[model samples]
Target: MGLIVTIIIGFFVGLIAKFLMPGRDPGGFIITILLGIGGALTANFLGRALGLYSTNEAAGFIASVIGAMILLAIYRAFSGRGRLTH
Candidate 1:
């Protein structure tokens, strides 16, 4: 139940992030889901570190999207799949 909800939300988050940051990304549905989930986790930890969220609190939607975008950027940099485009 909770997991399903998370996955669904993650999918949307990933799609939104990708749409916002236009570029050639790797993988498909599964990667999108992972990206979203990873973004949320990144936001959670980053928020906690920056005192934006409490220990047990989660990140907001906007923050999650931002995090996802950051993750996607990093992925593209490391994967070298979205560079050198004319």
Candidate 2:
């Protein structure tokens, strides 16, 4: 049940991140879901470390989206992609 909820949230977060960033990202639904989950985890970890969020709480929607964007940016940087244009 928790995993299902995470996936659903991830799906929407991925969609919104893609919309907000507007770039040629790789992968399909599975990839997007993975990205979303990764983003949420990253946000949660960072938020907790920075005292922006509680340790036991999940990241908020906006934080999740921002985290996804950050992940995308990191991916682009590592892959040598200059900018996203799509």
Candidate 3:
């Protein structure tokens, strides 16, 4: 139950992040959810390692969005598929 809730929250977090940073990416509801969850995980892991976030704390909404945006930036830089072929 808790895990399901977490996923739902992650989905929304991803949606909001994507909305905030609209960019080229393979996108859909599923992808958004995955991105969000991945971002949250990334933020949590890095924050804990850097002592910015405690182990018991999950990443905040803003942090999660920022993480997602960073991931999106990296994806944009590497994926190289969004070039508008004219």
Candidate 4:
């Protein structure tokens, strides 16, 4: 139940990140879901570590979206598909 909720939220986060970034991505639906989940988890953990969020709190929507965007950028950079061609 909790996992499902997380996945759904993550999907939306990932979608928003992709929409904002507006570029070619390495993967599709499954990748998006993974990216979102990863982003949310990363934000949650990093925030807690940095004292931005309490241990009991999860990452907010905006933070999650930002995290996803960062992850997407990293992914693009590593995959060597981030270059623009004319």
* Candidate of highest lDDT: 1
**lDDT of candidate 2 at residue 70, scale 0 to 100:** 90
lDDT per prediction? 0.91, 0.86, 0.83, 0.88
Q: Residue-wise lDDT of candidate 3 within 26-58, one digit each (tens)?
A: 878889888898888889988899899886998
**What C-alpha lDDT, on a 0 to 100 scale, does residue 6 get in candidate 2?**
88
Model 2 lDDT on a 0 to 1 scale: 0.86
Q: TM-score of predicted model 1? A: 0.92
Better of 1 and 3 by lDDT: 1
Model 1's lDDT to the true fold? 0.91
How many residue pairs clash (N, CA or C atoms closer than 3 angstroms) in each of the candidate models, in the order given?
0, 0, 0, 0
- Where is model 1 poorest over a 10-residue stretch in terms of lDDT? 77-86
Q: Candidate 4, residues 8-74: lDDT per residue as tens digits?
A: 9988999999999998886788889999998888888888889999878989999999889888888
How close is every model to the real structure, measured as TM-score? 0.92, 0.88, 0.83, 0.87
Per-residue lDDT over 1-86 for candidate 1, one digit per residue giving the tens place of the 0 to 100 score: 99999999899899999999998787799999989998899899899999999987999888999999999988888888658867
Better of 1 and 4 by TM-score: 1
Q: Give the worst 10-residue stretch by lDDT in candidate 2.
A: 76-85
User: Candidate 4 regions off by >4 Å?
Assistant: none
- Candidate 3 lDDT trough over 10 residues, lowest sum: 77-86
Cα lDDT tens digits, model 2, 1-86, are 98899898898888888888877889889878878888898899999999988867889888988899899889988987745558
Question: For model 1, how many clashes?
Answer: 0
Please tell me which predicted candidate would have the highest TM-score against the true structure.
1
Relative to the true structure, candidate 3 reaches a TM of: 0.83
